[model samples]
Each structure stands twice: as C-alpha cells, then as structure tokens.
Target: MKFSVFQLSRRGARARNEDRIGYCYTREACLLVLADGMGGHAAGDVAAQIALNSVCALFQARATPLLDDAPGFLAEALLHAHRQILRHAQQHHLADAPRTTLVVALLQQGQAWWIHCGDSRLYLARAGALLARTRDHSFRAMAERSGQPPASVNRNLLFTCLGSPSLPISDQAGPWPLARGDRLLLCSDGLWDALGETELLALLAHDPVSLCVPRLVDRALQHTGASSDNVSAIALEWEMPGAQSAPDSISTDALEGDAFESTLQLDAPDLPEPAPPVPALPEDELSEAAIERTIAEINAAIRRPGERRR
Candidate 1:
C-alpha cells in the first residue's frame, strides 16, 4: 500500500497563519493532522503547534510500523492535545487561553480512521463520490440538522473546541476501505467555508494529488480574494502497491512562513453552552423513525439556542 500527499498553507491577510498541518509515517502506518487555531495570533499559533507536537510525540511513542489500536491512539492523542493547550495556558498565566479546531487521520493496513473537533474537517472521496466527511461542532450546523435553524446565525460560532472549560466535542469514524484512486482531503474552514462541498469533490476528482492540491487551493481562493482566512489544504491519494512516496516532513513553521493572505481566525463563545448536539443523521440514509429518534437526542443535547454555519 502506497500513498501520495500534497499540502500547502497561506497566511491569508492575517499577521500570521494559525493553521498547522503535518504528516508522519513509518512503513506500516502514517498520521495526518490539520489544526486551525483560535484565540489571539501568537496564542492560536502556539495552541496549533502544541497539538501537532503532541501528535508527533504520540506517533513516536507508538510502534512506527504499526499501532496496536489506531482508534484508541487517535482518541488519546486528541485529548493529549487538549490537555497541552490547557496546561500551556495555566502555566503561562495567559488572560485568554489559546483554542483550536483539530482534525486527525490515521492510516494503517488499508484502512482509514479519524477524529475531529470543531470545523476543521476530513473528507474521504472514493471513486469520485464522497465516502464520508466529519461534521462541524458549530451551533448553525446543529440547528440545520434539527430542521429549525435561526434566520440569522453566525455559522462560524463554534460551541466546542480545545482549551475551552468543557471537553471539546469530537466526532470519530471509519476503517473505511481504501481503493485505488481514493482521495482523502483535510482542510480548515478557511478553505471549506470558502468553497462548497460540490466544488471540493469536483476538484479532488482529478489525478496526481501533487497537481490536484494546488488547483484545489487556488480554486478555493478565487472567490475569497484578500479576505481568504488562513487557507490550508492537504490531499492524499492511494495508488497500487509499490507506489513510491518521498520521505517528507511538515511543520508549523512552514505553515506560518508561507505567504497567503486573508483576514480569518477561529472564534469560540465564552458563555455556557447547552448540551453536545448529536450529529445530524440523514433520513434518506436511515429509517424515518431512527432519524426522529436521533433528532430527539440532539435536541436533548442542547439546552439553548445555537450558532449557524454558512
């Protein structure tokens, strides 16, 4: 099993790029991470770097060739990142804690598994169709699922995130089978919010991720212009056995150094939030009764009004 990767990050009108992305691998396993930082400039970048560093440590601690439990490892690593953020803030005595939205993907034994907190997302496309994508942990996203979104809601208002008082709400999935021509794309809202899913799918459907990734990023920026928000993207393609991949390493420093401009940053609410919303279950994908029950559960998860997504 072999895969290819293409990733890039731009500052996007901000003083510094807060989005961080990296991938590390041994012969049998590989880890992919994308983090979009919130809070202040320096703080947000710090939080994102901490998360990536935390993952690097976890990856090193586990068997490089293979992990015993990929899912469990992902869970612990994310929690570790969350704790690191908290620990950093307390130790430094900062007024506002740095927060972040994180998405991590682990690939092993021809399978994919991932976890996400906040809007940073992982999308899997197989044979030109969307296999799965992580949902955002935002108020607008919840209201949309419940079929009663407010007339005017800020879609970017994230209710859960790393460094918040409450544990960040995370969604996990997969062990999705991999096939030739499968494309896995992970990005921050700066990229996704600027471009719709349909556009993403269409762009990712092309060949040689090296070519596809830049095209995708360029396309995402076409509409946003100077206001583009730290745009970052990583794309991967699984090819036949013995497919060659170069030894590559990505770090937060590279992300911050890249030159792309847009005024975008992560923002989280300080007020107490309702319950954690259940992911919107699709009625077309499931039975009517099941969808109803899921909605009931989601409503129960929330205690008050929520934000919206664009």
Candidate 2:
C-alpha cells in the first residue's frame, strides 16, 4: 500500500496561536495526529506540543515496526501523552491546567484504526460519501443525543479532554478496512466545523494531499472569515499495487464493497481563506508572569459553562 500525508497550522485571528500542533507519520503504516491546546496564553500551545510530542515519541519507542498491536500502541501513546501534559503543568507554576483534543489514525495491513478525545474528528470517505466518523466528547453531542433542541447544544463546550487529571482519559479505537481509492481525513474542529463531508470528498476526489489539503484549508478559511479558529488538515489516499506506473496516475473507481454508497454529505458550510500570520513572540518576550495570567484565564474559562463553545 502507498500513502501521502501533509500538515499545516496557522494562528487564525487570535493574538496568540493557542491552537497547538499537528503531525503525520507512516512507518510500516500511517499515523496522523492533531492536537488543539486549551490553556491560556501560549500554555495551550505548550500543552498541545507536549501531548503530540509525547504521543509520537511513545509510539515510536513502543510500537513494533509492522504494528501488529496498533490499537494497544495507540492507547498507550494517548495515556503517555496525558501523563506528560500533567507533568508539564505541575513542573511549571502555570495558573491554569492545560488540556487538549487528540485525534489519531493508524493504517496497517489494509485496515485502519482511529482514536480520539474531545472534538477533533476523523472521517473516512469512499466514492464521494462518508463511511464513518468519530463523535465528539462535548456537551453538544450529549445534548443532541438526549433530544435537546439543536440550538441548545452549544458546540464550544467540551465534556471531557486530555490533560485534566480529574476526568478519565478517553481511550477509544476501531478498525477501518481499506481498499484501493479510499480517502481518510483527520482534522481539527476549526476545519470540520466550517466544511462538510461533501466539500471534503469533492476536494479530495482527484488530488493528492499537496493539492487537496490547501484547497480544503482555503475553502474553510474563505467560509469562516477572520473569526475562524486555527485550521489543520491531513488527507490520506490509498493506492493499490501496480497502480503507480506513471508519474501521475488516476485509477478506476472500484467499489470496495456495498458497505457504503456515494450519496452521503455532511450539512455544513464552506471554509474561508486563511488569515494573515500572527507574529511569533520572541523567546524572551514570553515571561513567566504572562504565562501565569494566561493559564489563570484559561483555567477560569474551562471551569465556566461556555468556554468550549468557541
């Protein structure tokens, strides 16, 4: 099997880029991760970076090359990341406890396994329709399931996430069998909240990550305007054996099975163009006091009822 992956991050309209980090790695198979930090100031950034780094490092160290135990490996990686985030927060006297949303995808032996926490999502598409997705661990999901009014379930507030020692760390995974011409997308809420499955499938229909990712980002930004949150996207396309005879190859659309059809589309808006970059603060410019203030605000917001709505 052959795969392609790409990642990009921008600060959005915020004064600082709290959005954190994203990564895509394929050894025997593929591992894609997106982490959105949730502390104040750059603490969110720190928390996100820590969680992602820890996850990748643990996966590399513990997971076997062929990934026979991919699910266990992913779960352990998430647990390690959670611990690392807690350690970092304790080491520093940051006022707010840091947290993050994590989404991971691993492809092995023609099968895919994914796990996630919070709102970042994983979507699988085949022949221009969504096959499956990971549901968000947010208040909105609960309210929707409970038959509350759609308007009552605010999308911003999370019910559970990584980093908090109080909440049970979520460890969820499932297998996704793959075939030729299947597409997988892993992204942060910033991107999916604006764009729907149809738009994503259409953008990825005939392109590689190099072309499709930017278009997805550009479209999300265009639709959301400057107020949009930080945007990150990773697209994976499966190529069958003997399908890459030429520099550019387009394969015939063969159905994997009748498990999914080609008519499903998510009812969401298009994305907008990306905003200008936020100036990065100098190393010395990030003072401990400033970090503390940010952490405090972040903690207060997390404790409140609506901080997650944004």
Candidate 3:
C-alpha cells in the first residue's frame, strides 16, 4: 500500500479553528477523515475532535490489515461518532449538543469507500476532471439540485450533522476501483466555500497532494482575505504497488498484521463508551410497525459486532 498524502488547516479570520483533519492506515486499509465544527454551536471544536477520534479508533480496531465489510463499517462508525458526540453533551449538561460536519474515505482492496454527513465533502478525481464528490446535506445544495434558486438559500445552513438530536442522515458511496493516478480529497466547507471547483481541480490534477494541499489552502485564504473561514483539507494520490513514491509517500508493506498507524490525536474524551442495551420487545415485536421502530432502536443499542447485550 503506497500513496502520497498531505493535509493542512488554517485559522483564517476566526478566533480559533474548530476544524479537524487526520488519517490512519493499516497494512491493507487507509482511513481519511475531516470534520468542520459548526461555529454557531458551543464546543464545536470538541464535536469535531470527537468525530475524528471515534472513527479512527474503530478503524484501528477493525482494519486488521483490511475491513471485512467496508460499507457497513463506514455506516456503523459514523453512527458511533454521532453517539459519542451526544454523550459529550450529556456529560457536560450543555443546552444543545455541539454540531459538526463530517466526511470519511476508506481506501482498501484496490478500491475506495466513503461516507459523509452535513457539508464536509470527499472528492474523487482522475485524469483531471472531477469523477465524483459527495453532495452536501444543506438546503443550498438540495435547492440547486432541485433546480430551485439556490441564491436565496444560506450555504451554511445544514439540515443534518453529527451531534444533532436525531440520527444524522448521511450518504455513502464506494468500491470504486482505483487507478494509478486517482486523487481523493476530504475537506471542510471552509476550503470549498472560498474556492471554485475549477480552481480546485486544476491544482489537484497537476501536482501531488503534498504540493496541491498547501497551495489550495493558500489560495482559499487569499480569496476570502481577512474574513476567510477556517480552511482545512487532506488529500492523497493513489499509486499502484511498486510505483515511484512521492516525497511524502507512505508504504505499509513492512507493517505487521496487528500494527496500526495514524496522524489523528486522541484524548480523554475520545475514549469509547459501552453502548446501551436494547430493551426487550413485547408480544407484538413481529408486527411491521414494530419492526420499523426497532430498526433504529437496534442500531442505537448495538455498538460493535457481537457486542454482548447487558
């Protein structure tokens, strides 16, 4: 497993940066994550950090070289992160939970899988053009897609995010085969909001991530000047085995089966908590309505594969 990767974050005009980005890898899998803390909420930075920590911890535990169910793992990890954020709010007795946008990309088995909630995004590019990217869970994006006037919609107004009261609605895509020069980028809204897609593509297509990422952040800061939001991005260029590695390239060939590597910084709040048990169902459990109700209940109750009910 070899790839060139780069990540950058800037405070811009904000008092403090609430955005977070990081990556981790095992011999057969890589996990890239980005989270943008919503400035309107309290403890936004904490929410962003919790999101990264929960997801990376799960990756370290499950990616014993590679995940057996990439898509399923993506979904579960996202939900787990959301729950962790809620737990933080509960523990702190906050009036409202801190909120954040999240995006994650998992590279393994010669393909890629991704998931996102809210405005943070993942872009997959090959041969210059943008091949794919996640859709933002904001009214602005939905309005544009529905052919409505997006100008009237507030771009920062997102309808879903981690740490919200309800289950966050997220999108997932994957198993897309990797090409030798394929590029994947995970970023906060701050970066994309300041720069156009054309500018982003040009930079990504022409240089390695280590080069493009810094340039991208610089240009975004220039575009918004003193009022720029917190800009952050992490990107990587996929390379086939035995390919010439970039200056900042990583090779996991020497790692043992149980070894794990990561750039994410984990702290006390990042620790995993035991999931609550699902209450036993009554006699009508087989009813269709009951089944619909229990789906969410079961998801909330089960944390990991084969976790014992307590």
**In terms of lDDT, which candidate is strongest?**
3
lDDT at residue 104 of model 3 (Cα atoms): 94
Which 10-residue span in candidate 3 carries the lowest summed lDDT?
Answer: 265-274
lDDT of 2: 0.62
Compared with the true structure, model 2 gives a TM-score of: 0.75
Give the C-alpha miss distance for residue 209 in model 3, angstroms. 1.3
lDDT of each: 0.70, 0.62, 0.81
Residue range 1-310, candidate 1, lDDT tens digits: 4777777777666666788776656556667788999844347877886776566445544533478898898898898888878877889998767999999988878889999999998999986799898988988888888887545668888889887878888888988888866889989898888888898888888767777777877777777888778888878787655544434312112222111111111222222133232333332444334533543443343335555310
Residue runs of model 3 more than 4 Å from their true location after superposition:
265-310
Candidate 1 achieves a global lDDT of: 0.70
Candidate 3, 154: how far from true, in Å?
0.8
Backbone collisions counted per model: 11, 16, 0
Ten consecutive residues with minimal summed lDDT in candidate 2? Answer: 258-267
Decreasing TM-score order of the candidates: 3, 1, 2
Alpha carbon lDDT at 204, candidate 1: 87
lDDT value, residue 210 of candidate 2? 64
